[model samples]
Target: MDAREAYSIKVISEIRLERLGLLYGETRIKDNDYVTTVYLKDKPILEGKISLPKFIGDDLYYVKSEGSSALMRQSLYGEPQKVVELGKVLKYEPHGKGLLILGEDPLTKAEKDAPLVTSKRKYRFDGRGLLRTRTSLYLFDNKLRKVIEGDFDVTDFSTNGKRIVVSTSQPDDDVGLNALYELNLDNGEMKRITEKEGSIVALTMNENGEVAMLGHDRGKLPWAIREVILPEEGKRFVCGNTCGSTVLTDIFDGAKERLIFRGDEILTLGQIGGEVNIYRISDGKTEKLTHGQHVVRLFDYDGESLVYSLTRPDKPSLLVRKDEIYDPNPNFKGAIPEKVASSIEGWGIITGDNPTILFIHGGPHTAYGYSFFIEFQFFAQNGFNVIFANPSGSQGYGEDFARRCVGDWGGRDMQELLQFVQDVKKQYNLTKKIGVTGGSYGGFMTNWIVTQTDVFSAAISERSISNLVSMCGTSDIGFWFNAIESGIEDPWTVESMDKLMKMSPIYHVGKVKTPTMLIHGEEDYRCPIEQAEQFYVALRSRGVEAKLVRYQGDGHEHARKGRPENMIHRLSVKLEWFNAHLK
Candidate 1:
């Protein structure tokens, strides 16, 4: 299969409900062009380079990018009309007969002339770039009115006509914890509501002023499973001890529904092992509603019909409404990965042949499950067997397992990965030629593997971490992530520095003999492009086979949401390198 075949795939995401019926979004990639279409009741309603389409009453509201971003509204069978100009609209919700939007305000003349200055601990984010402008929630009634601005960022909010609950974090506070505030819709008065330490990613309210949220308290480490919490009642419900939302995926679907209220029952998506399904909680009892090996990316229920977007190992995303299936990419003929049995418990292998590629997921907390992975499918189509596993520090497993790699990044988890590879190679009678590749935490492991042993024939480290000491000050979340992940209160301390150095791959780069290829996004603040640069220089200085591929203007999410041409070029380059080294 040609790497260019990636253009043939289409993905459906953000299953929602409108006044008429089901509403969803579809994305299509063809050559260098990327197009998105909005569908209502299984029919195309609006099509453009727009995103985050929502139905407020009988009108469709969405964000469109034309040089900059503009909020556009279109009625049923009517033309799209521009509502307002916004700077990267993050979210918008219906408020009474108007709208409540959260986004960055346009730069004023004075602001644009002023130097970039900040007193905050963290000033940058991975995908959103810089925090130069403050995010604010605005009310768009007859005229635009500023409701409130975030000290850092306004993460999420929910309203019930009379009042609204907003979740935000201060600049100097811990990024893991967010404070919830309730604002009066009439008087504009606001008060903090949360009396506990937790982060609320999503929230919903009932007519009776009851609020339920999907978040975690970091009780199970930084990657704590998100559970449904009722702050007013001081009660919480676990979704099988798993996350109450979908985990990471390569496909660029917009945000998924985390928590919603179906009358008195609370509905959420639960991740367990290699599957994500729908779960309902009512009267202190939790029940799984849907069962399958596939991942339900997005869903909406209206007391009767249950509509959702699902993806399997062999399928791209398709919308399912009751018994009817709506596939956006019906003509996609790309290669699909076939699941194979693995000797290692909780590991997954997609069959192909010799010269296998062991792909590692990024989060170390995020898991690879029974879902469609375009990258894995691309490798399989190009004649390479793919193997992946959750290891110890992954979610969807129990809390203990999810936090196993905490304070032990390259210790037990690294050893287990090495053992799993050897065991799988022997079990499948694989060839000696094998490649190791990953991004973020997986990238850290790839760099570590090359340093620890020369078992791999080739290595591709993307947006990886090389030096923990440098990462403490460079990466976006490094200030706190380093301390939490390393179990060190202060990473700058001499003793903690020693521990961090021992876990850093760059410390042991002298032992690396495997031919390595470093890929990085120039704008990636999460791992920082300097990480790849340092490793590349180190390898080249030692006369080892090495190459560095930098993607200009792309960020940490380049692999999943970068421009179509760059994505295709990346795949082609990887295939070429693997073919030359392994084939």
Candidate 2:
């Protein structure tokens, strides 16, 4: 697509979706830039005014405009009715006789100036702009007036008309995991429902307080659907093994209890097995409904059929319908790489070989899957064998496996990754030079690897975290990201800071010998570009070959959804850097 032709469309809501009537919002290129508009099917109904539209029931809809704190209510055809003012909303849903707004409150002068860490050391955070604010939950009545409020970060919630089940996490926990809480809409009371060790991914409750949830327990335990006869007492039994990431879950009564969920159909990285699929669990039997290589998202299940979207490696996303084929760019032929699934000492790898790049996926919570990735195909086309692995910290594995890297970021995780490389080398008997690259957490791994050993001639670290201590004060979510993994309650004390420093690659920069390329997005607050800068400077000062490549006006996700040309450029830079140094 031309720079002047890029566009995006989002479907509004599922209120009356079964009736087959649809409302969509579009953001498209105009005057060589992007502007948002709303549409009714194929007709352009509203333009150059509103964006982020959400349907309210069947007759009304809500939309918010840029730089405005008010959400405008409008009719189906585009007539505006009323403007409802609210704080910046991060997430919300329709709730009992009103709207539920979950966002952050405006920071006060004293609060804004307060140090993030309660230490007397005066850490360097000034001029770094405002820190990420804490989120709170607010209830707006049917009249769109504020009714109830609380200081909690609501991650997930499900309502049953009268009651609501919310998953919330406090900032001080530093673990970044949410626990189940029950919110009584009638009395405006909230109570802790589950006090378990693991995070609650999905939850639903009956009037009796009996609950069913998709739980990801600490370390090695895979996400599972569990039944809690006494949820308020925090007791639960695993009902079914959910091999994949559990995204959504619900329950229904019958002769036997049954749970319906939409999650990954296969647990593997998609290199060898399945996709994000829908399932039904009844009588302790889990049955998968759809099958294919494509990633699937289940929206609503009508008694007759399920409304969904399917996306594959070679095509754009398509809604499940009579004519669902969509290929936005048909000119270029698809690059289909062969799938090679292997396990080295229990760790899994989707393999490619010699002149190969051992790519690590980010998140530690996010997995590399069978879904289409343009970057993978580009590397394969350029004659690079790609071997991406799910090490101990990767999500596709059970929660225990993922939890194994929590307090040991560069320890066992690095060892397992190294073993994966050695095993792949021996299996393929490759003599060619090897390269390595990864973004975010994977980027941190790349930095750690180069410092630990120079087995690889080249390394590319993108959007990385080099110094955990400095990062805690800079990156948007740096505070919790460090605390949770370090198992430290406060990151400012000398002991905790020492631990963080030891874990950071910057502390070991003098050991790095591999020729490195440090790439980052300038505006990335997640792992700020300063991370890349410091690493690059340290490498260069140590007489190691290094280059810093920064993408302008781009954030953490530049490679995936940034400007088209910028994405291509980022990939091209990676290829060029590897091609130049790998040999």
Models, CA RMSD each: 2.2, 7.2
Please give each candidate's TM-score: 0.95, 0.73
lDDT of each: 0.79, 0.58
- Per-residue lDDT over 1-583 for candidate 2, one digit per residue giving the tens place of the 0 to 100 score: 2211222222221111324354444443344233555545545556653544566665444545444345666665667765455445544566656776655555556876776763312222222234335455667664543333433346566554456777776422334466666777667677876555455555554434345565544522222223322355344343222333322100000011122322311111011122455454434445566566655532344334454544455433345543454332455443444444345222222234448788877775555544445565567666777776667666544446657788788898888778777777776676788888898898999999998988888999988989999988887667766777776878999999999999999999999889999888878877889999999999998899999988887777765545545665677778789889764
Residue 265 in model 2: shift from native, Å?
17
The pairs that clash in candidate 1 are none
lDDT score, residue 70, model 2?
A: 54
Backbone collision tally, model 2: 7
Considering summed lDDT, which 10 consecutive residues are worst modelled in model 2?
Answer: 248-257
Local error of candidate 2 at residue 281 (angstroms):
3.6
The TM-score between candidate 2 and the true structure equals 0.73
Q: What's the C-alpha lDDT at position 459 in model 1?
A: 95
What lDDT tens digits, residue by residue, belong to model 1 across residues 446-523?
999899888889999999999988999899888788778988889999999999999899999999999999999999
Segments of candidate 1 deviating more than 4 angstroms: 31-33, 108-114, 171-176, 331-353
